[model samples]
Target: MKYSYYALFTTNNQGRIEVTFPDLAPHVATFGNNLPDAQRMAADALVGYLLTAESLGIKLPQPSSFQDLTPDSQQRLIPIEVDTKSN
Candidate 1:
């Protein structure tokens, strides 16, 4: 399934590209020194995250259009706040 994700990208202190999909809590990663490279790396990061979640039986939040969800649940998928780093 293709879920719509909100991505944020910016240069890091070390000059690498930082990327985040706010919809996925604690699911951020980074790579490369530019946007294109960072994008490929981010894609890899998502695949790895999902694979690991499936392997460990972690429950991924179901994808939903925030408008179709309750206000509380909607917050989880919105990019209200973001830190300038990756984990």
Candidate 2:
């Protein structure tokens, strides 16, 4: 199954990119040194989160629409896609 979710990327004071899935658990987060790296990490995190939830039979919340999300100036809303079968 393929899942789509939004990742909130924010630049911290130390200049690192912090990524989080707002619709998911608050503890479900990842970070990287830069945008590209952060994006990769976000995808990996999303995949792991979904896989774990599936194995545990936990129901995940529906993804919020991109238009409905509001990211601040220091943050960006990015869409992430993951396929459980491929993983």
Candidate 2: pairs in clash:
none
Give per-model TM-scores: 0.59, 0.95
Error of 2 at 12 (Å): 0.5
Model 1 scores worst on lDDT over the 10 consecutive residues at 74-83
> Highest TM-score: which candidate?
2
- Across residues 27-86, which tens digit of lDDT does each residue of candidate 2 receive? 579999999999999999999988999999998899999888898998999999999999
TM-score, candidate number 1 = 0.59
lDDT of candidate 2 at residue 16, scale 0 to 100: 97
lDDT, each prediction? 0.57, 0.92
Error of 1 at 37 (Å): 0.2
Predict model 2's lDDT versus the native: 0.92
